[model samples]
Target: MADNQYITIMLQSLHKKEKVLNSIIQINKRQKEELENPSLDPDDFDKTVEEKSELIEQLELLDNGFEKLYEKVREELQTNKELYKDEILQMQGSIRALAEKSMEIQAQEARNKQLMEQKFASVKKQVREIRSSQKVVNQYYKNMMKKGYVEPHFLDNKK
Candidate 1:
């Protein structure tokens, strides 16, 4: 392939990678919003999680494809040093932008992960508190029974 053709292919791959990264970032933002909702439906959350997983898979595929294209571009440039310098420079700029976008997505994902961990911890604490309270209630009932107090049963009068 000609030098120009190699540059074009690299540029296209970079653009596709950027688009996928941007999409994944947007999905992360949406998931964060849903996480913040106290009444978020479980089904909706599941769907969002599934969509995010699919987007991540797509991003991985795009990254692999971009890497292959980048290697080809590098090989072409090294062999044909007489190619258009301006086009090669432009391709470099695009590659840099793609790298920046990927970093942004990664940062967003890290934040989301931290937020999820905090939420999980909070729930675990709540569960522990509930169990402790139940234990205290059970102990109280046992104490009453030791004092010869009989268990009381209540009948609902409402028909």
Candidate 2:
């Protein structure tokens, strides 16, 4: 069954227990009230006694019923308690696995970012060096042409 369904069933069992306990309490209260003030008239006294006896019998029957119900509920609660424990353990295991996976992913992402940054810095350095070399080569070519050590490429191509 689903977790929520189990929880709902447990709640219903608790509600049943509360109702049964309240009924038992009310019955005891009534019995106490009757005992507190006995009937004085002989005829009324006989009638009261008969009514009390009937009430006692009914109370005995109710007590027996309540005992059986209580036992059943107790057994059910014990079984459910075990089931709850198992479910909690399962949830804990799942959470731990998820946490481990998250940590691994985060670590991998961090390493990848670090590697990317290093590569970018290396590329920038190489670009700066290439630009500087290009400038030096251009200066050398211009000086050679002015000194007549080499003909300008444009003049040679025109010839």
Candidate 3:
């Protein structure tokens, strides 16, 4: 195939990859919302994660294909500097967009990670409180068992 043809294919691959990245970014935003909500739905968050994984798989496939095509056209494009300038520029633009999306996703993921850690900490505190309460109850029962004297609520009728 011609170098231009290969370049066109690469461009298409880049577009597909960009779309996948956009989907992932949206998923990250949704994940952030889930983390921020006081009452998070585990099932919904799980579904979003699973969906993002599938999109990532698609992105990987596109990357592989783009790399293969780029290798095929590398020599020609390098040697013929001005021959395929337009397509090369388009590909560069697509790459720039992809980079921006990637950065955005990274920032979103960082926020989400922090939120998740906070949620975990809150749950850990609750568990500790419950355990402490249980221990106090157990101690009270132990103390009660050692006392055999029954305290009379009403005074004895010795009057």
Candidate 4:
């Protein structure tokens, strides 16, 4: 490809990457909403997790290509800075925008993770409560058995 073509491709890839990042942000927002609900369905949450995983995979693939294209563009800009001064400036602007978006996404994701951790802690507490209740019930049954408690034939009969 020609120098201009390479730069054009890199710019397009950057825009695409930006769009993917935005999608991730939206997905994380949805997840946060779901987590906020009191009756969160496990199945629904699993679906969101799957969707996020797929989006991340795509992002990884895009990054691989983007890196190569970025290196090429950088080399071209360095070698012919005078000739491609305008394009280089444009690329810089796009890069700055991408960095800002990435930072925003990172913040949102961190919030989501914290929410998830809180949820997990809550679930663990409930499980502990349930186990403790079960233990009490079992102990009561064992005591009754030890005392030879048996079924009474009549309501007034004590056995």
- The number of the candidate with the highest lDDT is 3
Better of 1 and 2 by TM-score: 1
Per-residue accuracy of model 1 over 1-159 as CA lDDT, tens digit each: 564676677678777777877887888899888777766677987898899898779878867876776676777678766665776777779778878887888898898888778767877898999999999998899787786466699999999
lDDT of 2 at 72: 49
For residues 36-117, could you state the per-residue lDDT of candidate 4 as single tens digits?
8879999999999999899889888878887887776777778889998887788788889889988998898899899999
lDDT of 3 at 100: 94
lDDT for model 1? 0.79
By lDDT, rank the candidates, best first.
Answer: 3, 4, 1, 2
Give candidate 4's error at residue 76 in angstroms: 2.4
Clash pairs, candidate 1, are none
What is the per-residue lDDT of model 2 for residues 1-159, given as tens digits with 9 covering 90 to 100?
444454444444444444444443444444344333433244653564466456446545644654555454555546677756654454456446545644554564465456546655766898999999999998899787775366457545563
lDDT at 16, model 3: 86
Pull out the clashing pairs in model 4: none
Across residues 1-159, which tens digit of lDDT does each residue of candidate 3 receive? 577788888988998898899889889988988888889888988998899899989988999999998888899988887988888889889999999999998998899999999998987999999999999998888778965456669868897
User: What lDDT would each prediction earn against the true structure?
Assistant: 0.79, 0.53, 0.88, 0.86
lDDT of 3 at 150: 61
TM-score for all models, in order of appearance: 0.73, 0.37, 0.83, 0.83
